[model samples]
Target: MQIQDLPYPDPGVPDARSGPRFLWWLFRNQLGGQVRSLAWGLVHFLSVSALPFCVGYAVQAVVDRSGTRLALAGGLLALACAGNAIGDTFLHRAAITNWITAAARVQQLLARKAATLGSALTRRVAAGEVVAVSTGDVEKIGWFVEAVSRFTAAALTILFVCVGLVVYQPSLGVVVAVGLPVLALAVLPLLPRATRRADFQREKAGRATELASDTVAGLRVLRGIGGEELFLDRYRSASQEVRHAAVRSARMWSLISAIQVLLPGLLLIAVVWHGVGLAREGRISVGELVTVYSSVMVMTYPLRHFEEIAMAYSFSRPSARRAARVLSLRRATSEDGSQAGTAPKGDLYDPATGLLAPTGRFTAVVCGDPDAAGRLAERLGGHPSSTEEEPSVLLGGVPLDELPLSAARTAVLVQDKDPVLLSGTLRELLDVPASGDVDAREALTAAQCEDVLAALVQGSLGAEDPLDARITERGRSLSGGQRQRLALARSLFTDPEVLVLDEPTSAVDSHTEARVAEGVRELRAGRTTVVFTSSPLLLDRADRVVLVHEGEVVAVGVHRDLVHKEPRYRAVVTRETEPEPEEPHDLQELEELEEIEETA
Candidate 1:
């Protein structure tokens, strides 16, 4: 898969059984790229290794004063140089292709997973951790995958060089072969410590990242409450912890690097010492001695691959583990293996709470606890609740879980209490993937969003339309009420069959709230609309009101009737007591003054 063809047609399900297995799966998927990289890498390293042999032959030709041999050696050197250049270029190309494709594959998997889990993803994984995995962690995994092929080529080149040396000169070849393995394995004992430090550093870094994200998201709130400095200090402490862990990790890796360098130098010295003795005993020629020395020096470059591979594995192990954790999460309904059947076409019902929103009617649900109300709204839209078994909500008479995900979402739309406004122009925000005929202007009017439109027009340049005005991320520039109204307008524009709103008017003033209630009632006259709120104005407008207490429906009736009949319902809708009337003396004095004025 090339980078241009990215966002692969089928990213395919990942083997998320474990970190190592996931890495292996990625490697297997990109086998073609990996093979190309390995092939080119071998060519490059082999050409590099053959250079010493060519140079060694040229030196012998010069010593023997043979022009023919000298010409042959020169030709061989040119061939080796040409091969090295071509191989190096292609190797680089193949390696980069592998890296980009692997990272793209991982990104696709993450995107698919995020879509499947939806909002539940944030509850299962931190927003910061998810960001980290999709961004930096994916690159690290790709780096490991790309490095594996190069490391394999390096090892193979080294082995081939050793075999060539043994055939040319057994005495020095044995010494070189034996010493290379020692150099490579010398740092194995330190890897465990290095890996532990890397894991700790990564953990601290993830926490710091999460803290920073949270701080930025709540910056306005922090400033309002005068808690910005506290959060800053907390982030500072977290960053310091990450720094210390990284330093400790670097120290261990540095020690391993030292061992790698020191051991190779020692091996080079041992090979030279043994080769000189063989030369003195007339067992090896000067050219042979130079070849052995150059080969050992060349081996140093390949030996570093050991350290590179080790470092890659150490960093990628935790990243792969994190990616696996996210991919392993499945929807609650899918986990239990029960097919609830397709979303039925009718009223929305939550069996768990015994609350029913009838078709073509406006229903208001009042709950004492806001959280319970939100969960109920979610359940009504077919979202699973953690506390419930067989967490399925029915649409018409069909269980929501039984329907296809797209069909279910299309049938019932749930607007959360704090709905997100994606960064876009007003027009784009309302351009949702809706199935029914919806007019954006009508929805905006119904949502009481005139003020929002005026604000947008005022913020824009001359002659620019308000609908074309750009909104900042999460609509942070807009007031809470404006954001809420805009969100409601967007939801309305979807024109879903069943619309569930949780405290849709909580952020607006009473006057605006009443207008929104009336508008919603008028616009959704023949559709199911469920509003989870205790606002008296909104409740009084609903055709039917249900009181949900402690997760069950405790009372059902008109808002005015319930207010007088149920104290619990009355207490929630009207928290304060009513004042008494004026005294009898005050009433008699006002009547006598009115009679006197009339006589005069």
Candidate 2:
């Protein structure tokens, strides 16, 4: 395939069981491209090999003093030169196409795998290792794939030349044939040592990269606590380790390179020495002697490809292994089987927690244990903990865990308690895979971010539009409340069939939280939403409230009724120290409610 047609429609599922299998899978999928490259490589190798024979023919013709022979040799030389040029051009073109397409395919697969794994990817795979695999290892893998075809052609050309030489002149031919194979195989003994050193270098580099990443990510915190120098010193030590390992690996590879040159030089000397002896005994002509000498030189060129392919394989094998490990990670509660495309249309229920959020209602959940709250919220969205054997969250009549990942995601979206905001423009941050029904401004308004856009614009780097303003990494430039609201806005933009939010407004002030609660109630009208919070502002807005204690649902009722009638629910929400609050305290609490403002 051409480079322009690349990044294939889908990178197809990878055979990620092992490194060798994954590498084989990549190469096999690109068989058509590889075959074409192999053909061009063959042309290049054969044409290059033909040049030596053509020169020898011309030499013999000149000695014979025959004009016709001289003219014929000249014509053949021109043809061989033309063939050589054409073959080299196409060989390089095809090889490059193979390399880029293979890498692009791998990139797509890794991206798909990452999307499937979500936040869990970093948990299972080191962040630095993932970065390293994506950035550097991908190219090395593609290089090996591209090298395989050329190496085959080189080996074939070597065999073909050896046979031709033997038929032309036996005594000299034997030496050339034996010496060429020796030159190719001589570096094999050193490869394992070189590869071990290379692997050590890669490991050191991955650790150093992880250290640097962690240092950068926590730089602000480190500076706050005055621990900057400590981290810097640690990273410095890691960088030194990486440098040392790289030097050791380079030393081993350098030895291999020296052997590549030394062996070929020795082979050339042996061929020439034998050819001269044969010529003296009248067993070979001057032209024949010249042919054997030149043939050895030609044969030595393709031998370099052998060493290159070996190095490529050594580098790429480990790369493929790492990529495979990442790709093989499966979500603990997700299924990859057939599923309906449409979202389930009914109540959301978590069987283990016995929490029921009825259809088309605003439900607020109060969990006495914060840990329990987090777990329930994630479980509601089908992201159950791997160690727990909880029953699947159900929707309509279907278990979400049994549904396809995309279908399950479409049915419900759970905004984590601590939502992360990646660095990007405000517009890009909100540019998520969504139902596309809710407008960004509408979601922003619903999340009570009416002032956030203005703030972004004021702090923007010359950008007049708030949506176009750049957000620093982790939204560090924005306040905690602003970040939380923006995250809530992003979730609202998706407009899913059911939305579960965990401590979504914990960072906002009481007044703003009240407005946000009302806004959410209005915006999510006629849709199901489960909000996990003990804040009366949000709970009072709920059409129904659920009280869970120690992971089990203990009570369910209207917020005001539950506060007055249910002691356990009241204690959890009010943080009660007495049997009940005083009359004035009750009055204050009632007035603060303002009763959720009837959804705007």
Candidate 3:
């Protein structure tokens, strides 16, 4: 593939049976690039291999005192030099091109797999493993892919040289042929031990990486609990383990490298000694002796590629396996085993909890345990739990697992409590696959996030519009309230048929939360909306409130009636405070407060 065509439009479904199989699949896909690289490598290796012959010819021509033949040798030597330069240049060009394109392809596949798995990716694999596979593993895989063609060329070039030597003088040729194999095979016994050590090092490194990732992700929480020092100690221990393993791995590789150096030198010595014996016997000319020695020296260059290929495969094998494991994860499938149809529409029901939200109504779910609330919210989005055999949420009598991923996602949009905001401009952040019914302004206003837009405008460094203001990664630059509200706005803008929001207003102040609740109730009218919260303002605005204690529904009614009757529901929402006799604030009153806040 061309560099410009990189990031393939379709990275095609991968074969994930095993790491070696996956590597084979990647090789098959890039056969054209592999061919191009191989062809260039042949040109390069062949040209360099011809140099020893040129040198020998020149020596013999001078030894015979033939002026014409010496002149011809000079011309051939110059051509060989030019060929070497041209071939080496193009070979590198093709190898690097293959490397970049292969890396890009793997990256795209990982991205696609992550998107398909959604939040469950972290559940199945450690966050650090995913990070490592996407970053370091990609390059290793590309290294193996790029090395394949060059390795083949090197082997073929070695074979050509060995044959030429055997034909030039049978005695010297046999000695060189036998010696070259010994030199090449000498490191084989050491490879397995080196590879084992390397694997151990990689495992330790991965564990350290995982610990570091977990520490960073929860750094804020760790500091709050005064446990950063404890985590630091743990990470230091992990780092030390990694260091020891790495040292062991390096020692093995160093031994192998030493063997490689020593073997080549020994082979060169043998060739020189044998060539001199042949010259003394008058079985080979002085010129032939020079050619055989130069040829043996030249052989070292191609032999290096054998070690390179081994190293490349060693590093890439595990990386490819890790990537394959991730790609093999499949979402819960339907009972019928198909996912190519239209999205269903109806009451949102969770059979596992026996909780139901009627069609086109705003429903509030109050879970005493926050973790339970988050899990239920994820379930509403068709995410399968490790404990559950399949996703039990259904829409219009059809299980969500039965629907295509695109259809299910379009039908039910879930905004978790800790929603992430990728770095981008305001426009890009809000640019989701949204319904045309809700525009950016309407959604922003409904989410009570006008202040968020105002802050972005005030923070702009240039004459950029509010929509053009750039957001930092994960919205780190914004306050907790602003990030929450901005995410809420994006959800509202999506305008899905069914929306599940978990603690969407937890970060905002009571005043802002009250207005946001009213805005949500009004804008989501006649659409299925389920909010997992204990906030009184939001609960009161809901058309129906369900108290989910433990896992099952314990009580269900309007918020006003439920507060007076269901003590569990009242205690959860009101935090054990005596329920006020008065109903919630009216919509017009909240709107007036919104106007006053804007004026201030």
Computed on alpha carbons, the lDDT of every model, listed in order, comes to: 0.88, 0.88, 0.88
- In the range 1-600, model 3's lDDT, one tens digit per residue, is 889887797887789899899888998999998998888888888888888888998999999998998899899989988988998998999999889988898999899888877887888899999998899889999999899999999988888778888997788888888888887888898888877887788788888888999898788789889999999999999999999998998888888888888888888888888788879988889888888888888888888988888888888888999889988887774322235678788999998788999999999999999988988888888987756764479999999887888888889999989888999899999888998899898999999878888888777688268889888888877888999999999999999999999999998999999999999999999999999999988988999999999889999998899899988887887788775776438998778878999999
Which segments of model 2 are wrong by more than 4 Å?
A: 332-339, 366-375, 385-387, 418-425, 433-437, 459-465, 468-476, 534-600
For every candidate in turn, the CA RMSD to the true structure comes to 8.3, 9.2, 10.5
Q: State the displacement of the C-alpha of residue 5, model 1, in Å, after optimal TM-score superposition.
A: 0.5
Instruction: Name the weakest run of 10 consecutive residues (lDDT summed) in model 2.
Output: 333-342
Q: What tens digits encode model 2's per-residue C-alpha lDDT throughout 1-600?
A: 678887687678899999889999999999998999899999999999998888999999999998899899999999989988999999999999989998998899888888776665775678888998897989998999999999999999999999998998888888988888888899999999988888888888888888887787777779889999999999889999999998998898889889999988888888888778878888889888888888888877899999899889888888898889888887764545345566678999888879999999999999888977887887788877656787888999798877788888888998888788999899999888888888998999999997888888888869887789888889888888999999999999999999999999999999999999999999999999999999999999999999998888889999999999998888888999675654645876666556555444
Residue 508's lDDT in candidate 1 = 95
TM-score of each: 0.92, 0.87, 0.92
Checking candidate 2 for backbone clashes, the offending pairs are none
CA displacement after TM-score superposition, residue 577 of candidate 2 (Å): 11
Which portions of model 1 miss their true places by more than 4 Å? Answer: 333-343, 385-387, 576-600
lDDT tens digits, residue span 1-600, model 1: 877888898888899999999999999999999999999999999999999898888888888898999899999999999989999999999999999999999999899878766676776789999998998899999999999999999999999998899898899888888888888888999999999999998889888988998898789889999999999999999999999999999999999999988888888888888888888998888888888889988888888999999999999999999999999887653432233434457878888888999999999999989987877787777767444684488787888776767677778889999888999789889878875576888899999999999888787666277789888889998999999999999988898899999999888999999999999999888889999998999999999999999988999999989999999899888985657886547877889878999999
